[model samples]
Target: MKLDIIDLNLSYGSTKVLNGLNMQAKPEITALIGPNATGKSTLLKCVAGILKPTGHILLDGEEILDKRNKELREMISYLPQEIPDLTTLTVMEVVLLGRVNSLSWKVSEEEIDQAYGVLEDLGLDDLAPRPMTELSGGQQQMIYVAQSLVRNPSLLLMDEPTNNLDMQKQLEMFELIKGVTAEKEITTLMVLHDINLASRYADQIVVLRDGKVFCSGPAEEVINEDIIQEVYGVKSTVHFHQDGFPQIVPLCSVRCLPWQKRKDQGLAHQGSVDFGQQN
Candidate 1:
């Protein structure tokens, strides 16, 4: 699937969220990255049909912006940032819920097998019978990802999928997602805060700034020192790994508030400035 966003716009009352946002995502891992409040999550919600935004959103040249919620849910699988606490449900039950649209009064054997297949793929098959509340944050996160995958969607949208995961789990999850995306030819769009991870995992990186696309392309074309400084207001060194992915080494913030202002406000001493305070 190929997703095209044309002249997209969204707002919360008077505050605009997505302003004329445009981007193209194909059947590959495309990372949507930016600083906070850049509309990265908002865009994903819009595509998932959780939020309505004025625009032309086309899936392989078919307009889907006006599609009904049930219709859109069939074509797109969305994993939100916050993991839901489903204490009453087991991992298997949660995973099966992904196919809720197709489920009848009795869940067929085929649906159970399909759900198990996704769990096995994610190495969570053993956790199928366990209560969701008994698992750790990372384990629950993985189960939600499994839930999303069980939908067998053409387009997958994940918001901070690796939020609660450790370093190893994060790597494992990304590798799994990338492998599945390539194998199934699913259009995957992920909202990621870790730019280095995005560069390493994403086939294409889309940088959003203030509700619009700042820059987007292959990591090599978009991940550079100038972009880092401009988009993130941080000074960083960009180095390529042996596998040809860009690794970012952040040094310091270029937009940190002045020392005098911090001192005058009694937030810091005269000689020391708070790097946490940004313009």
Candidate 2:
């Protein structure tokens, strides 16, 4: 499943969010990383067909921009950044809803089993009967992931799928995502804020800046200190793991030194004024 973006342009009212964006997503996990308002989320939304773009989005060389909603739903699964509160449904029921697009009128026993299998695979079997409203944010995140997987989509786009989880839960989420993606060979693209997490899990990384791609390639090629500072405006040291994955340790904001210089000059000016007054 090859996903290709060609001269993609998207706008919200008058402001352009994605400007001539181009990418070819591999069959493995690809991480979309950038600072705020750089179109990370917007790019996912455009590809998922939630927000229409003026350019082309192709799946396996077929144009997907003109596909019907049902057809698009069958090929792709998109999880938004904010998980809505499901007050009326249990965890199992919420996951079963993923099968709705493929189902006819009545739900089948095989579909029920499939949903249960997904929940159990993600270790959410214990919470199956529990109401979604009763679960923690991390627990709900797991359930939403289960819902996304139940559809068995060829393309999975997740927007910050691990927003509020603790460190351990975040690791678990990434492991589960990577496991399923590799096992199913799903073409997965996710918006991630943490550069280290993206480098660890992504087969390729795309960095966006000011509604355009700054640089994109394998983690080692794109996650250098210079690119990090250029894209994110932060001074970072990138180290490679023994397995050859990149890790980013942010030192400070690049603007921090300039701000400190201005502060010192202000103090010096005040001292000169005080000395003149004393004289």
Question: lDDT for every model?
Answer: 0.92, 0.88
> What is the Å distance of residue 26 in model 1 from its true position?
0.6
- Which 10-residue span in candidate 1 carries the lowest summed lDDT? 99-108
Model 1 misplaced stretches (Cα beyond 4 Å): 101-104, 258-279
The TM-score leader among the candidates is 1
Q: Report the lDDT tens digits of candidate 2 across residue range 1-279.
A: 899999999888899899999998968999999999999999998888888888899999999999988999989999999766675788988888788943345888998899999988877898989998898878888889889998898999999988877898788888988998999999999999998999999999999988888889989999999998888888988889998998989999967575588787774433344435553
Best by lDDT: 1
Displacement of residue 15 (Cα, Å) in model 2 is 1.3
- lDDT (tens digit, per residue) of candidate 1 on 225-274: 99999999999999999999999999999874777577677775657566
Q: Give model 1 RMSD, 1 decimal.
A: 5.2
